[model samples]
Target: MVFMGIDIGSTTSKGVLMNEEQAILAQHLVHAGIGTSGPAAVKKELLAAAGLQDEDIDYTVVTGYGRRTYAEADSQVSELSCHAKGSAFLFPDVRMVIDIGGQDAKVIRLDSHGRMTDFVMNDKCAAGTGRFLEVMAGILQMDVSELEQEAAKATQTLRISSTCTVFAESEVISQLAAGAEIPALVKGICGSVASRTAGLVRRMGVEEKVCMSGGVANNGAVRRAMEEELGTEILYSPLAQFAGALGAALYAMEKAGKEKEHE
Candidate 1:
């Protein structure tokens, strides 16, 4: 049987398909635009990409901030749970998961068996999330992907003291007006984001085998800064961005199995 998971996030939508054995078959990610339309569109795209029709799926699970709006899902799960589950599947020994998506960040603690034990989330603002980086990128006239590379070239360290997105943008503007080096300024921005994320991780209490997931985990500069601040080697999967979706797929598989057992 085929199982599917969909994550409708604030800034992106992701989908994953799993076979009866819970092995991933295909996964897809796309920018989440206005409302529920983005995830609905992504779900169709993933079904097409996997060469399967909606009828082929045995169960469908939905997750993330917009989970409730997805009328087609057989069930809905929390992003926090899905993230921890996905991180555990990728990194078997992972005791911690730090997920930074478009508008919020999460720190999840896991037990030895990969079950979520505790978690803390920062959903109040965009300061420590991908949106923050995008704002900084706009100020520097650089693409979000270029921020990490530019920060990597830094020869001097600069500190971005503001945790508020508005203030931080103003800070970047002021630095740019003063003819500050772009690379150093970018490094500072990455550092600031890392610091904010690290604070959340600290609140959850660090453990061995730390793993990072979500869109921000794709940024090399932010990952490096997080590693330094947390004083641990972090594990990342190429599947980071799709972790929540993958977790949802796994849950679908589990639910299907239980139904079969009862039958």
Candidate 2:
């Protein structure tokens, strides 16, 4: 039987389909617009990718910021639990997970068995999040993807002292007005994000074998800066964005098994 998981994040929606053996069959991710249309968008895409129909799915679990609002899921799970479970599945040695999404950031501490033991989250502000980077990129008149390339070209890193997004934007503007090199400014922005995230990681106490999950994990500059701040190597995967969905899929598989046992 096929089980499914959908992660409706603030900025994107992701879906994963898995078989009884918990092997991934297909996955889908899409930008979420302002409203609640994300889950529906990814559901159609994921089902098509897996060559299956909605009726073919035996179980479903929904996760992420919009989980409770999703009507199609048989149940819902916390993104924290999902991230921990997903990180463990991908990196068995991972004892910590740093998930920086569009509008928020989270650091999850996991046990050796992959269970979430503790977590710290920053949802009150957009600072140090993917949104913060996007805003900086906009101020720089550059694309989000260009931040890494620009930082790579920097000969020396500049410091951005503000942690508030608005203040940081003001700093960027002032630096630009002063004719500061764009590459150095980009590196500064990345470093500020890393500093903020590293503080969160330190809250739960740093652990070896840290894995990064979420869209921000794809940013090389931020990753490198974070590694430097934390003084530890980070493990990342191309599937970083799908970690929550994968974890939900794993949960769906277990739910399916419980149903079968009852039958």
Which pairs in model 1 have colliding backbones? none
Clashes of each: 0, 0
Task: Give each model's whole-structure lDDT.
Answer: 0.89, 0.90
TM-score each candidate: 0.96, 0.96
Pairing residues by index, what is the TM-score of model 1? 0.96
Model 2's C-alpha root-mean-square deviation from the true structure amounts to 1.3
In model 1, where is the ten-residue run with the lowest total lDDT?
32-41
Which regions of candidate 1 fall more than 4 Å away from where they truly are? 33-36
**208 in model 2: Cα distance from truth in Å?**
0.6
Where does candidate 2 have its weakest 10-residue lDDT segment? Answer: 30-39
Give the per-residue lDDT of model 2 (tens digit) for 1-263: 99898888888899999998778999988888226677898989988988888899999999898888888799999988898888899999999999998888999998888888899998599899999999999999998878999999999888996479999899889998999999999999999989999999998899999989988898999999999999999999989989999999999998878888999
Per-residue lDDT tens digits for candidate 1, residues 102-212, read 889999999999999899998598899999999999888898989989999999968895379999999989998999999999999998899999999998788998989
Q: In the order shown, what is each candidate's alpha-carbon RMSD?
A: 1.3, 1.3
